[model samples]
Every structure is written in C-alpha cells, then in structure tokens.
Target chain A: EADIYQTPRYLVIGTGKKITLECSQTMGHDKMYWYQQDPGMELHLIHYSYGVNSTEKGDLSSESTVSRIRTEHFPLTLESARPSHTSQYLCASSEGQGRNTEAFFGQGTRLTVV
Target chain B: QQPVQSPQAVILREGEDAVINCSSSKALYSVHWYRQKHGEAPVFLMILLKGGEQKGHEKISASFNEKKQQSSLYLTASQLSYSGTYFCGTEMRGGGSQGNLIFGKGTKLSVKP
Candidate 1:
C-alpha cells in the first residue's frame, strides 16, 4: 500500500468557512499533486509541486492554493469555501524522474461545502 | 491536451474479458493507467513509456503504440473487484521535467458475477 495519507477523509462545512486539506507522504517523493474529482467523474489537476518551494498551477484552474514548505507535506487551503468547491480532493506522489514514474495516491478527502 | 477514451462505459460478466482504449492528439512520452473504485482515490495500474512497450500485471495488461499515440488496456477473466472507473493519463514529450499528466474522461467498467 502507498504511504501517502490525507486527513479528514470526509468533510462537510458551511459556506465561507476557511478549510485546509492535509496531505503527507512518507515515500519522500519529489513530485506531488492535488486533483479534484466529482462523483463518478474524471479527475482534474488543480495544483502540483515538482519539489519543495516549487509549486505550479495545473491545467484546471482552482481557487484553492497549496504549499510545499516540507518535502513530505503538501497542504491545500481554501480562503473561503463554497458549495461549488464541494468535491473529492485526491493527493498523489511519485518517486524518481516524473517521466517514467507511477504515482501512488492517498485515500482522498471528500469535501462537501454547504 | 487531455487524452480521449472510447466506450464511455462497459459491462461484463465474471470470467469475461474487456478492452479499454485511450488516444492522444499530441505526441506522448508515456501513458499511465489508473483505476478508481467508488469513493476512493485512483490506483495506478501501470505506466507505458515510449518504444511501443507492453506491460502486464496478472490478468491485466496494456499496450502502447508510440506512432499512433494510443494505448489500450486489456483485462482477461474479469472479476467483480475490477469494477471501477478506468482513466488514461498522458504525458507529452515536452511536458517538462515534472511530466504532468493530462487524463482522459475515463471509462466505467462494471463486472457482474
């Protein structure tokens, strides 16, 4: 099993509340990513980091922001949550050069903004 | 660009077989296959790099065609545990060192016992 873990496997909060989704991996992978997925839908990349202090926005635009101050942690935060932001967020990490590597994923956090 | 997957959904009986195909419009450096069960994160099945390589894991196998910029996943003797959504992620040749993956919409596979 993958060593990656996400906190608050499920969350339901009121609108306008600030929330943070935590992701941590013990694999010491340099590449980490956050993806948003709706029920039974494809995953959309929201943010990714190549390494510590190197973050990039993915193809899909997202209001949430992520930080990678530590190699093993990549947490995503929402300034103010909205119902529109309600979706499952998945965290993944891959070792070696990103080119030919396979990503291992966490269990994912299911966010439900009310 | 995101890869395109054919046969949005498929249904099969236990012990049957199925094939899922993914195609990219741009040249690809690699193709990755992942399976996501209900209410869970996607699990990586395998990754196929350039050179038209083929990889297999137990009853699951995949083939990559570099020239066609396409990849196919084959599941023989499907099991109920194989019921899930399958996604194909493509990494473009010039997608940078990070090799960010752009995924297809996904194909849902349902296996009935």
Candidate 2:
C-alpha cells in the first residue's frame, strides 16, 4: 500500500511496565517522527529521526526514547510506562524537503496506561 | 516553534465556505495542511512552500504568504465529509535532518448537511 504502519493498534498496560511502539515505512522516507496526541487536543512532537543512527528530542520533552537503526523503522520505547504517558502515538514520515515533501501518517497507536 | 491557528472551532453548513488561518511568529520554509476525522488518523491536504503559492487537494485549497508568515486553508462548497479537525504544520529551514514539522493547536470544523 506504500504507507506507514504502526503496530499494536491499541495497547493497555500497567504502570511501570516497559513497552515499545513500532513504526515502519515502506515508502523509503528518510525522516520519521513520533508525536503524542491526547484525544481532541494538540499534537506534541516527542521524538524524531533524520536517518539511520540519527535521533533527536522534539519540542515536547518526553520520557520515552526512540531509535532509528534502519531507514524504514523508527520505534519509541519507554523504560517505565506511567499514566502520564497515556495518549495516542502517531508516526509520520517524509521523503525530502520543501513543499513537495508531504508527510504520510500511520493509523496511530492508542495506548492506555493504568 | 508552534504556529497559532485562529477560530479554534467553526461550524458550517453544506455548500458554505470556511477559511481557517494559521500563523507563526517564526519564518517558515513551508506549511503543510491535514484534515483529521474524529477517531481517525490525519490525512494530508496540501503543502504551500515559501514562494507564496497555492495548492489544492480535493475540494480543499491552501495559500501560504511568506511575508505574513501565515497560511489560510479554504474549504469551498463544504460537504459533510469536510467535518474534521484541520491542523497546520509548519516547517522551518535548517532544523537538522528531521526538518521537524511543528503543528498548531488545530481548528475543528463541523459541517452540517
């Protein structure tokens, strides 16, 4: 389908549990981002990767960490999940720069922390 | 930096037109638009670069003004399908490889048939 995919469409976990949300792109994009969005609220960038071995924290300081070992895979991990971390995680990827470079988003992973 | 979107929420009737504006204090390289339905992921609408050009996706068109550091999305002949939250994402030059796109609070649009 030439799109981005996020695994575990929905997750419900206990507090202090380690978890990882997987995101993969089949479009071979170089840029990938992880955004945290609460229901009907604004989206906050948590983490992003430019390319392989390149990752950076986003505008929103997050307790979660991300890795970009491959061009297509960008996964977000939390050492200890908390109720504060409960939110929808969205994954997006872009090809290049400028107006032509539009980002494609995945369906998103809705996580509920208890 | 995050852009600011005006008219946080709007209600329109079918066939009516609505304009949602996005403004940023910082200069922008490009502005991207997306529409997200309730309980669904956002869908890309269009991208307007700094050149002050206009782009349209489906019935939605957007314009970017470099001088004003703002972008406006026009929804002409609104339909029930147009009911969703509209978000404007701004991308500035030289922010590392991610080119991170910062989004505004978004404008929620409700279209009634």
Candidate 3:
C-alpha cells in the first residue's frame, strides 16, 4: 500500500461552509498533486506542488486553494464551499520529473455540500 | 493535448481477450496506465516510455508507438479482478508540462463469469 493518507474519508457540510481536506505522504516525494473526480468519471487535476512553498493551478479551474509549507503535508482549503464543489478529492505524490516515474495516490476524500 | 481513448467501455467474459487503445495528437514523452475501482484510488498498471517499449504485468500488456503517438493495452484471458476503469495518461513532449499527466476520459471494463 502507498504511504499517502487523506483524512476524513467522507465529509458533509452546508453551503458556504469553509472546509479543508488534509493530505500527507510519508514517501518523501517532491511532486504532489490534487485531482477532482466525480463519481465514475475521469480524474481532473486541480492543483499541484513541486516542493515547499511552490504551488500551481492545473488544467481545471477550481476555487479551492492549497499550501505546501512542509514537505510531507499539502492541504487544500475551500474558503466557501458550494454544492458544485461536491466531488472526490484525491492526493497523489511522485518522486521526480522523470519520464517513467509513477504517482502514488491516497484513499481520497468524498465531500458533499448540501 | 488529452489523449483520446477508444471504445469508451467494454464487457468481457472470464478468459476472454480485450484491447484498449489511446492516441494523442501531440508528441508524447511517455504513457501511464492506471486502473481504478469504484470508491477507490487508481492503481498504476505500467509505464510505456517514448522509446516505444512494451511492458507486461501478469496478464496485462501494453505497447507504445512513439512515431504513431499511440498505445494499446492488451488483456489476455481476463479475470474478474481486472474489471475496473482503465485510464491512459499522456505526458506531452514540451516545456512546462513534465511529470504532470494529462489523462484520458477512461474506458470501463467489465468481466463477468
């Protein structure tokens, strides 16, 4: 099993609520990513980080923000959540920019905004 | 560019054979294959480098054609455990996009007894 972990496997909250999805990895990888996936759909990259204090937006436009002050933790925060933000958030970590490197994913957090 | 996957889905019986194809419009650095079951994270199957090499894991095999910018995954004598959504992630050959995978919509495979 991968050493990555995501807290609150499942979450439910009201609209306009602020929430943070926590992701941590013990693999000591430098590349980490956040992907949003709807049930039974393709995975969409939302955010990623190269290393500490480095973050970038992905192909998908998301209202959520992330910070990587530490090497092992990358947490995504939604200042004001909405029903449209309800989806599965997956955290993945990879070692480098090598052409053959594979990413390890966490269990994922299922968020529901009512 | 996002690679396009063919046959969006396929259903097979145990011991049957199936193939999933992925093609990209842009030059590829490599190809990554992953399988994800419902309510779970995706599992890496294998990676096909730009050299157009073929890799196999148990009964699953994949071939990449760099010149053609295409890849094909072969599943021989499929097992029930192989049932899941198969996704092909493409790494385009260019600047600013390294290590980040642009994934296909995915192809759902179902294996029945």
Candidate 4:
C-alpha cells in the first residue's frame, strides 16, 4: 500500500469555520497534488507543488490554499469554509524529475460543510 | 489539459469484454489509468509512457496513441471486482510538466454476474 495518508478521513464543519486537511507521504516524492472530487464525478486538480516553496493553482479554481514546507507534508487550508466546499479531497504524490511517474493517492478526506 | 471520456457509463456481464476511451486536446506525454470503487480513492491501474505504448496488468490492458492523443483501456473476462469508475489522467507532455496530471470525467463500469 502507498505510504500516503490523509487525516480526518471524514470531516463535518459548519460554514465560516477555518479548516485544514493534512496530507503526508513517506515516499519522499517531490510532486504533491490536491484534487477535489464529487461523488461519481471527475477528479479536479485544485493545487499542486513541484517541491518545497513551489505551489501552483490547478485547472480548477478553488477557495482552498496549500503549503509545501516539507517534502513529506502538504496541507490544504480554507480560510472560511462553505457548504459548496462539501466534497471529497484527495491527496497524491509522485516522484519528480520529469519522469511522468505514476501518482500514489491517499485514502482521501471526505469533507462536509454544514 | 482535462481529457474527455466517452460513454459516461457501461454495463457488462461477467466474462464480457469492455473498452473505455479517453482523448485530450493537448499533446499527451503520458497517460495514467485509475479505478475507483464507491466512496473510495482511485487506485492506479497503469501508465503508458511512450507514444503507441501498450501495457497489461492481468486481464486489463491499455493502449496509447501519441499522434492521436488518445488512450483506450481494455478489460477482458471482466469480474465483479471490475465494477468501478475508470479515469484517465493525462500528463502535459513527453517532457513532463511539474508532474501534474489532468483527468477525464471518468467512465462508470458495472459488471453483473
């Protein structure tokens, strides 16, 4: 199994609450990503980091932000959560070097904003 | 770029064969295939690196056409375990792009025994 892990496998928070979803990988992967997926829907890339101090917005415009302070950890935070943010958040990591390596995904965090 | 998947869903009987197709407008450097069951994170099935590359995992295999910017996943002798949503993630280019992968909407497959 992949060493990646997402904390709060499930979260339910009220609107306006600040929340952070934790993602960590022991694989020492340089590339990390956050994807939002609705049930039975496509996985939308929201944020990604090539390495420490490097973060980029994904194809989807999301209200959440992420930081890559350590190679093993990338966390997504929302200043003020909303009901619209209720969905599954998946974290993935892959080896870098422009190798196009396969991504390893965590179990994912199911967030429900009430 | 986000890839497009055809036949939003498909139904198959045990032992039947099925194919799911994915296409992208942007040039593809690599194609990644994944399968996800209900309320679960997607599992990496396979990846095709080179153009016109074909790889197999058990009864499941995939083919990539670089010039056409398309990839197709084939499932032979499907089993109940094959029931899930299949997604195709496309990497930016052959040279790679920060190792980011854009995915297709996904194709839901149901195998009935």
DockQ of all models, two decimals each: 0.80, 0.78, 0.75, 0.84
Tell me the tens digit of each residue's lDDT in model 3 across A1-114. 799999989999999999999999998888899999999999998898888998988889999999999999999999999999999999998885663577789999999999
Better of 1 and 4 by TM-score: 4
Q: Mind giving the per-residue lDDT tens digits that candidate 2 earns over A1-112?
A: 4489999899999999999999999888988999999999998988887789989998999999999999999999999999999999999999854325778889999999
Q: Provide the DockQ value for model 4.
A: 0.84
Task: Locate the minimum summed-lDDT window of 10 residues in model 4 chain B.
Answer: B50-59
Where is model 2 more than 4 Å wrong at Cα? A97-100, B53-58, B95-98
After superposing all C-alphas onto the true structure, candidate 1 shows an RMSD in angstroms of 1.6
TM-score of chain B of each: 0.92, 0.91, 0.94, 0.90
Query: Model 3: per-residue lDDT, tens digit, B25-108?
Result: 988888989999988899989888887664546667888999999999989999999999999988788777766777899999
Fnat per candidate? 0.76, 0.74, 0.66, 0.89
C-alpha TM-scores of all predictions: 0.94, 0.95, 0.95, 0.95
Report lDDT per candidate.
0.89, 0.88, 0.90, 0.90
Give me the runs in candidate 3 sitting further than 4 Å from their true place: B52-56
Candidate 1 ranges beyond 4 A from true positions: B52-56, B95-98
In candidate 4, stretches whose alpha carbon ends up further than 4 angstroms from where it belongs are: B51-56, B94-98
* Model 2 lDDT tens row, B13-81: 999999999998887888999899988888889988866664657667777888889899999999999
Q: How close to the true structure is residue A71 of candidate 2, measured as C-alpha lDDT?
A: 95
Q: Is candidate 2 or candidate 3 better by DockQ?
A: 2
Error of 2 at A98 (Å): 5.8
